[model samples]
Target: MFNRYEADETYGLHVDNAIRRVTGSSVTVRADLSATLFLSDPEGYDGGELQIEDSFGAQRAGFELPPGVEAVNLKDRPPLPRAVLEPHQSIVFQGMMGEAPRWEDLHWLQRQTELPILVKGIQHPADALRVAEMGLDGVVVSNHGGRGLDCLPSAIEVLPRIRAAVGEDFPLLLDGGIERGTDVYKALALGADAVMVGRPQIWALAVAGALGVAHLLRVLREELEVTMALAGTPTIADITAEALFSGP
Candidate 1:
């Protein structure tokens, strides 16, 4: 299950029970993995822990690694040595069943799973490299739509630096100020593998719920196709930094 935690919410063992009831089996019985998304300011509160259950019925605890530690390589170790969060912050974890163990136990499980972990809401090249070091699959350069911190660098502005940090062949995604195909194009030129749209989806949901969302997606897809054709790019792979230039 993909779970998201907001500020002031403690997702305890009850989550296990809920998953069991909904899926008609325990989390261990059904899920091979789980990813939790955190959407709060880590500084706003304390004790919101993300606990993962191993196959042996053991629970391993993990938390968001503090900011500025993105330079720390977690490839063979834990990405977040400790829990950390700021508003609009998020992390992904690989869930495997085992005995509920201490931080060390969780670290062991993370090393074993070897799942591709990617963090969103990153804006610094150093931070991106740190994520890569943690052995993350990649990163999504984003500013949470300016929702988390004011005066934050736009995701586009930081893409080049982040790409340079991670090196070529590293999968990089982009988010923020992405409302049009042109925005997507710009992100690709700046060095992004893909882009995520948040506000537009929310707006569609608010205006029309499910149907509105469907329409919104359709519109975006059409716009992307048109933009691609106009840019003379026949495929996503063909769109590159050469297609863009610094404005005069």
Candidate 2:
């Protein structure tokens, strides 16, 4: 889940409620893992630190990034415009891991049997390669939906480079500028394992709450299926780079 506001304010309250509803033991089928991706630097604003609670109701990780120059480490890419967080500024943690061992436990679990964790908002293929080498499950090619930086390459345009950096079988998720089934198809053909829908999903929720969101997902799914059929692809695996062409 993404939190754009400070953690001690109204936004934090809302997040708590959402978590209760989604992962409370009484809800049945508790969530095995949860994470928060920071969209802003800790010093950029104030009070938006990420606080997590474990299954035992203990605050597991309450973290905030360092501010200013301290947050900008020498990454693989040449210097580029980017928001820098303070040390301990980024909050990343796993919420839960089921009994018995699994891949979910491999990355985040050693600390407490947690699930794998990853940080997104990456652009450079070298950066993606570095994260994959750290044993992360994958990286999502995104620009925070164009909200972070202007004139950034669309996620689609950078996906193949990231895929090559990470390797053939590594998972790569994409986010940004996806508005139709063709967009989804284009992303898949370009090597994205999955795509995330943001603004459109919010618009649906605003228009009709949960039911509206469900309807939106259904429509998108049907559209994607239809697009797949028309493209002579029978299943998700059948989608390949050959199925797409650069825009005219």
Candidate 3:
């Protein structure tokens, strides 16, 4: 969650089907009100609509505050001349999240840094091609895993076509459905720069903490090495789709 964006680098806008303030196909979000603390002076950065007011609280139509309510503490709807809740009490709010971001917002982000910006969840081959054409540095390909109503294909299943569409040079980071070392090898063979392994690590962490994670990584490495050896590909660079081919 922590990032070091230099003077020339800035954040971008987010837009999903629901216009969420999220970064990718999947994001870790907090349901409660969130706060952003600025370490640097406001005068030091590019001035835009960076600081927005945090107007929060429930937004239910025709929901009037009880006659005596000044500030709701939730229980005991008494007539009040004074505040009901302490300044530190927990409260729920479903305030406006604002409009979905426009594609033009990418330029605003690009103006700040020379660092590569990779968009996540570029599932379609055409989308991948379009992203590359738009000068995006790369993309994180994903299936989103939950098998939404459309029954979208996995990243690996579409990865080859995406690679063909974008060419070999553009960076492609495959994510989701990667459970084993052979999965990693297959991703590479099918033209992924790298693969993300979040679930297995989470499982490992839940089972044996940090050392479990280390053990999990070792196991994956051994599996990949064994697969490479059996396929007669001595090095990662030697793996290709042909190596994975057999009659089918």
Candidate 4:
């Protein structure tokens, strides 16, 4: 979930498991992994920190919101609680957002993750090259599905440039405007190691829930297979940049 915090807005320290009621049923799922991406320039915001605790209880803090924000739990049991802190008061924890990441943060993240870390929403070749220099596992070329910034170019438009910058061995993924199997094929041919489908899956789920999602994926896979065969690319590895062309 992309959460945008305005001035003084804060999310109290909490685990990510969420409860959702769908068709009069409550469903809960635990996330195996969590990723936080900072969109706003570090200098542009204050106090909206991405703070996390390690398994050993050590803490690190990143981005944050403005000062004077106090966290209150209104649903606390026993007696009703009185306001303890005023709006102008800023609380400091063991982990504070006073320091932001430059080089150390990236190295810290790489050290912590056993699984491969792929940074997403990268549109610039320089950013892709930076990801490689930082020793990141991969990069996803995306315009954030065009949901965050409407004016940005599509992921496909930048895929080749980023791919060229990162070199052939680096894994690159693409996300955005993928409505058909042909779209997926095009992305792979254009240099995306893989493609992500977003709204189509949501639309399918909205129409028929799990069954719809399964059917839609099955259809997409079949269509992709047919496209590959018809285009004379028998395998995914065979798909190349020559398969794509620009049009007026």
CA lDDT of each candidate? 0.70, 0.70, 0.74, 0.74
- Superposed Cα deviation of residue 121, candidate 3 (Å): 0.5
What are the TM-scores, per candidate, against the unseen true structure? 0.54, 0.55, 0.58, 0.58
Cα lDDT tens digits, model 1, 1-248, are 44456657654542222122223432222223455555456455444444564432122345555776554455577533332322222222222223224435434656877676667777888878877776668788888878778899888988998898999898999888888878877888778888888889999999999999899888887888888898898898888887776789
The reply for model 4, stretches above 4 Å from the true place, is 1-103
Predicted candidate 2 versus true structure: per-residue lDDT over 86-180, tens digit per residue: 22222122232222345445445445645665557878998788777767777889988777678898888899888888888888899998878
Q: How many Å off is the CA of 202 in candidate 2?
A: 0.5
lDDT of 1: 0.70
What TM-score quantifies how close candidate 4 is to the native fold? 0.58
User: Cα lDDT for residue 112, model 2?
Assistant: 61
Can you give the lDDT of residue 84 in candidate 1?
30
Off by over 4 Å in 3: 1-98, 147-150
> Which structure is stronger by TM-score: 1 or 3?
3
Pairs that clash in candidate 3: 8-112, 8-113, 9-112, 68-79, 68-80
Candidate order, TM-score descending: 4, 3, 2, 1
**Candidate 4 — which pairs collide?**
46-65, 47-64, 47-65, 48-63, 48-64, 48-65, 49-63, 49-64
Question: Which runs of model 2 end up more than 4 angstroms from their true locations?
Answer: 1-113
Q: Model 1 TM-score?
A: 0.54
